[model samples]
Target: MQNVYLAATSATPEVDFRFDSHRMSLKGESYPENAQAFYGPLLDAVGSYLAACRGTTIQIDVQLAYFNSSSTKLLMSLFEQFNQAALAGNHVLVNWFHDEEDDTILEFGEEIAEDYPALELLTQALV
Candidate 1:
């Protein structure tokens, strides 16, 4: 599958998904006017990629400074996809990076960890 790359905008995060390498990352902030429109294609791509893989190690890194409720819902869906991939026997590792002072982001990461036990979630505090 071809890789996916979306440059970061003021209201959206940068999406870099390298299917060949099984690595993906989202950075910056996400509060798009239409969260579904922004995340739908990404979710499709990730689902397709995960569906094609077996016994692969996938690394996903997310470092969003801020996001809105809509973005939060979509982000959880993204993590759910990874969790499913892990349940299918792939080694999925998700690294959630947040500012040291940002309890919200850290808490969100913790929530993901709690919700998705199949995938390994690493909450990293950025200083």
Candidate 2:
């Protein structure tokens, strides 16, 4: 599968998914008007990639300064995919980055970690 790269906008985050490296990054803010329109294809691509993976390690880095509730739901679903993939034997690492001042984002990452315990979830303060 081809890599997926989406540039960030004022109301959306940047998405960089590298098929070859199995590395993905989502950065910037996210509050898109149509969350489904923005995340549907991205999720599909990720699902397809995980389905095709053969015990490869997948790394996902998330650095969102802000994201709306809709975006949160989408992220939850995305993490679910990571959990399933990891449980299936592929190593999956999720690095969730949050601003030092934003405890909410850090807490959110913790919640996701709790929900997807099978996946390796690491929360780090953004530098």
lDDT of 1 by residue, 9-126 (tens): 9999999999999999999999999999999999999999999999999999989999999999999999999999899999999899999999999999999999999989999999
Would you list the C-alpha lDDT of every candidate in the order shown?
0.94, 0.93
Candidate 2: tens digits of C-alpha lDDT, residues 50-125: 9998788999999999999999999999999989999999999999999988999999999999999988999999
Q: Name the candidate that leads on TM-score.
A: 1
Find the number of clashing residue pairs for candidate 1: 0
Error of 1 at 87 (Å): 0.3
Number of backbone clashes in candidate 2: 0
RMSD of each: 0.5, 0.8
